[model samples]
Target: MTDPETLAAATVVVPALVAALVWVLPRTWVTRTALVGALATGGLAAALTAVALTGDRPLAGPWLVIDVPGGLLVGIIGAVGLVSVLVSPAYLGAAAGALVDPRRRERTYYSALLVFWSALLAVPLAGTLGAAWLLVEATTAASALLVGFSGRATALEAGWKYLVLTSLGLGVALLGIVLLAAGTPEGGLGALSWQVLPTYAGGARSALVVYVLLLAGLAAKIGWAPVHNWLPDAHSEAPAPVSALLSAALLPAVLLVAWRCEQGLEPVIGVGPARDVLLVFGLLSVAVSVPFMLRPMAWKRLLAYSSLEHMGVVAIGLGFATPLALAGVAVHLVAHAVAKTLGFCLVTPLLAHAPEAARSPVSGIARSSPVLGGAMGLSLGSLAGLPPSPLFVSELLIVAGGFQAGRVVTATAAAVLLALAFSCLVRALLELTLGEAPARTGPVSGSASASGSVSGSVSGSASGSALPGLRGVGVLVAASLVLLLALAGAASWLPASDLVDTLMKGIA
Candidate 1:
């Protein structure tokens, strides 16, 4: 026997060890170091998934558990991390080339990215809720450096804000964890494992208090309203690749934690109370992010708000707790990850050519780089839940689930908010894709050749400059398309009942 328990722990710890190695590697070898680290993480993720699917049963150990849900999430984080590393050569290559100390900065960036990936992978595999909490905190710490990698005054400020807000949120979550521990049988003193939660979940009052505390605290981390101040700043300031990972991977990881916590408490306080809280938060996040999306701002910031909106949608699906809704939530998480990553990748090249593209003032990207323009259009369209996109299927499932759950009013409100969000996003996309290219001044005849020369020079030297290669915008777009097809096919064939059964069993 290949010792599933040992494999499960290794799946996570090995990545962390690799990240540490990347941190110490010579500056000149930063690219190779990052690639090696990412490859190791991806391989482990693949192993974990295979074990979950083909192994006899869930792998259980004192430190970790490779259950179906955890396996699925681990695979996602790993796959995405791999793509991130592929893109990093190009993206971070461009950044490093522009830096005062390129070698040192490249090492720092790659190290931080690897560390972030390792932390993200660890959370889902944790056997205990306490360990999960620690992993989430680790993600914040590792990503914070990446957020402020530019070392600009604004980047620094944004990083500090992110640190303070997330730390506070984690603190509150810790308090909730402590309370839950205290309420466990035998005066709450025990191993504090997630597996034991159901056994001691009978104390309604304590469970309710702990659930509320945990949800409220973690809600901040998920970028829910009122506490979502750090999102725009952090996402906007971070490199595009980092931003993609943050939005597409990090937020979902925290949401998974919240989902697990809800499952733990549902048996005690009933699903109604937990659903109610999710509904409230979902509505608030939608309402708060909508107006921001409508306003003119940086391209990355706009995407960040879009992330908030999507998180709200995920919350709604989770609150419904119906099999259809949960399935939708699952599919939507995948859809959002692919769409957002592609969108971020597309914008990277655009921003390089026209710095104002980030501000939404420059237009006509379709004429400048038709491929990227189309990719951006498709990504936004998908994110808006338009037909043919996986988001559409997920949102519909969520709505259906809400109706089934007798939350007609809630469903109606979510639908309306989604429609409004869709409209706003569509309008922005049109302006960016269809408008005339801003006029260039001075020596129009030589501009084309000059621009081409510059573009070629930039692309030839740095990894990011040659984006058509592996892990480039082209690859991201292809991946998005494939995922969308898979989602649509799965939705059409997968039974809702089966999803419900799996969710119930997994959570129970």
Candidate 2:
């Protein structure tokens, strides 16, 4: 088969088949088989990325396109999906007490997860604006079921809010898509295809209007402020693996479309207007997240804010739109995907060791659980943009790129905000990983006070419930660190290519 066809089948059809097969499998085997399938999918994505990097252009078909930028997102979603699947066994174990019918719920949960995985796969491969929007909405529906899978009252509420709010955003996005389609040369569904739309609408007056409407809807769906009310609640309430996917995959995948839209409209509105709009959205997202990020917070909610901050970083990079900046944006996307997955996965052990600590103030991780503490510390460092972390390099490049683009004020603002965000995250990480575990009274004891040892203290708590030590955790942490190393070198080390040039050429 042809390369484009091969990549499309692997990215889209294979996952759909696996998702269907999951329900019929024995519940005990579901997680194992899903991981295997997800790994294979990730491998395919990596191969596709390699091909795109070497080729002059993306492998495109009638309904799908696999370009360098799109391939990066595809690879990210696939890699994060595999990691989330790997982490799911532990997540399911942590939720065991709350699940009424272990076997049935396991089946239901795995089914939903695979379906969610399949929908994510479809997102980056979508060729047309309408097709991309539909796949994104599909993700919301599939993940909402997984988010509320625990059946807790708050879980249900979070799920409903996620469904309603994101759906509203998608509705708005659809209007923009229809308007964009109307303005294209042929003025049909085909006009909205990524490859064709840019050529025409990039210089159209109507395209400017479409771009504004689309960016607003995308900002909301992607967890930008003023419309981000559902993000923290949903991420906090959902299972850890699902939370990882939402942050690592869904947000980026949707933002990919928004970035492309901005590129297409730049010629029509001029680069300044489009970049200014994105810059405002990006900066506002960064600023609005600060107050929540500064205080003591739930683990998932904190990471949710981190997602918002990083997405803003990406927007700022795109607004800069130089080759160096675009390169940093590419590297940053991969780095954040791997690092954030590690951050979310570490919470599984925390839940198993100190279930109450999920929402409680952080304490005793260093003394109680060395592995969780180390993993979390590294994640915090990476997310905080500490030296040797890819994020530090990525953020630096974006700032430098902004200056080169003559956006001195924007560059200064970005650097300052990043430093502030870093301090807050590092402080929170220190509090969580160090210091004595808070002592709880009565039948429910604390991790530090119970047995003077990590395992025993965790086991002693009634809610802690004796769960097996987390598996494959060390591997996830090790992989994330290695990914950071690769990201740090990616901007300079990548072979001579027109990837960044291609991405920027159409923008203005």
Best by TM-score: 2
lDDT tens digits by residue: candidate 1, 83-125: 7777776665344222225547777778788889888988887
Give Cα-based local distance difference scores for all models: 0.75, 0.76
Which 10 successive residues of model 1 have the least lDDT summed?
Answer: 442-451
Please give, for residues 134-199, the per-residue lDDT of candidate 2 as tens digits: 888888888998777777778889889998999998888888988877677866677877767666
Q: How close is candidate 1 to the true structure, as a TM-score?
A: 0.90
* Native-to-model Cα distance after best TM-score fit, residue 28 in candidate 1, in Å: 2.5
List the candidates' TM-scores in order.
0.90, 0.91
Report lDDT (Cα) of residue 11, candidate 2. Answer: 69
User: After superposing candidate 1, which stretches have Cα over 4 Å from the reference?
Assistant: 1-3, 53-57, 96-103, 186-191, 200-202, 440-471, 497-500
How far in Å is the alpha carbon of 141 misplaced in model 1? 0.9
- In Å, residue 344's CA in model 1 sits off its true spot by 1.7
